[model samples]
Target: MARVLIIGASKGIGLETVQRALAAGHTVRAFARTPVRLVGADTSRLEVVKGNALKTEDVEAALDRVDVVIQTLGIGLGDMLGPVQLFSKSTRVLLPAMEAKRVRRLIAVTGFGAGDSKSSISFLQYIPFRLVFGRAYDDKDIQEKLIKASSLDWTIARPGILTNGHRLGTYRVLTEPQDWHNGTISRADVADFLVQQITDRSHVRKTPVLVY
Candidate 1:
């Protein structure tokens, strides 16, 4: 099993990924600013590191003795209107840390509507996408670009709008921008795909639009 570092493992998809990664038998280093509580998990294999991703030292410290990096960094919907640099700033620090540590694999959770997927967003969701998530997604575009330009074996999982539903264990991964349609997927399912990518090499260097 690989040692995995999840950058935002406090709540949302990041927390779900922690549960899923543990179940997959991977040694997980859970990084978050808030306290993390995992129910019925083996604490020996899971390391909870409380720190913000924005700090270079914190990010660099978390990469120690890790084989793969899975970043699930997110910002609040309310804070999306303000200056949101979590994704891009975190990536800037993380990429160098991973390089310094010689960790080559990175599976980052950048949602749909980022990068070229804007052309594929549905008309029904277009207005809200712009009015609500425009700024954050713009930074995600920068996040994607930085990851793409890096030397790491990267698979950018661009999941659609996420819900807190049960894991279906089924979803479509659209690689082409034109086929990247907007849809709702469970947080557990997105975590499932991210964990699967830890060992699956098929999606390396590909940004697949994950949806149901």
Candidate 2:
């Protein structure tokens, strides 16, 4: 199994990915500002590294000798309104670090309204989406552009409305622009896809919308 570095490994999809990847027998370095939550009895192959994703030194340290990188970084709801730079800024730090380490495979979790997927948002839902998630999603747009512009073997998984549901292991991987639409998906299922991408090259250089 490959050694996987999971950024933002404290909670949400990141935490789910850590569990899923470990269950799949991949050694995981769980990076987060406060990853104490990840300490468990069966942490034999898990390495919990507490660090800020925006710090160059911190991110570079987390990228050590990993075969693949899965970035599932997220910010709290409180930071959604103001100017959000976590996604873009950390990505700026991430891409070059990955290059330095020669870790070319990146599985980044950007949501449905990011980049071209913004165009897929319906006219009715567009207003509220703009009102609430506009700022964060805009930064995700920048994040997507940076990844696309890079030479890394990248697969962007744009999951729709997230929920705390169980992993059914069944969801739509919408690769075509016409099939890109928003719907609810479990964080576990998204993690399932992320783990699958560590070896699956079919979606490399492709951004697929995940939905149920």
Q: Give the per-residue lDDT digits (tens) of candidate 1, residues 1-212.
A: 99999989999999999999999999999999999988887778899999989888898889898999999988888899798888999999999989998999999999888877778887888998889998998899999999999999999999888899999988888887768788889999999999999999999999999899
Model 1, residue 170: displacement in angstroms? Answer: 1.7
* Per-residue C-alpha lDDT of model 2 across residues 1-212, encoded as one tens digit per residue: 99999999999999999999998999999999984465453578999999999999999988888999999999888899799999999999999999999999999999999999899999999999999998999999999999999999999999999999999988999999998999999999999999999999999999999999
Which pairs clash in model 1?
none
Model number with the top TM-score: 2
Give candidate 1 regions above 4 Å deviation: none
Q: Which ten residues in a row have the lowest lDDT in candidate 2?
A: 34-43
What is the overall TM-score of model 2 with all chains considered together?
A: 0.97
TM-score of each model, paired residue for residue = 0.97, 0.97
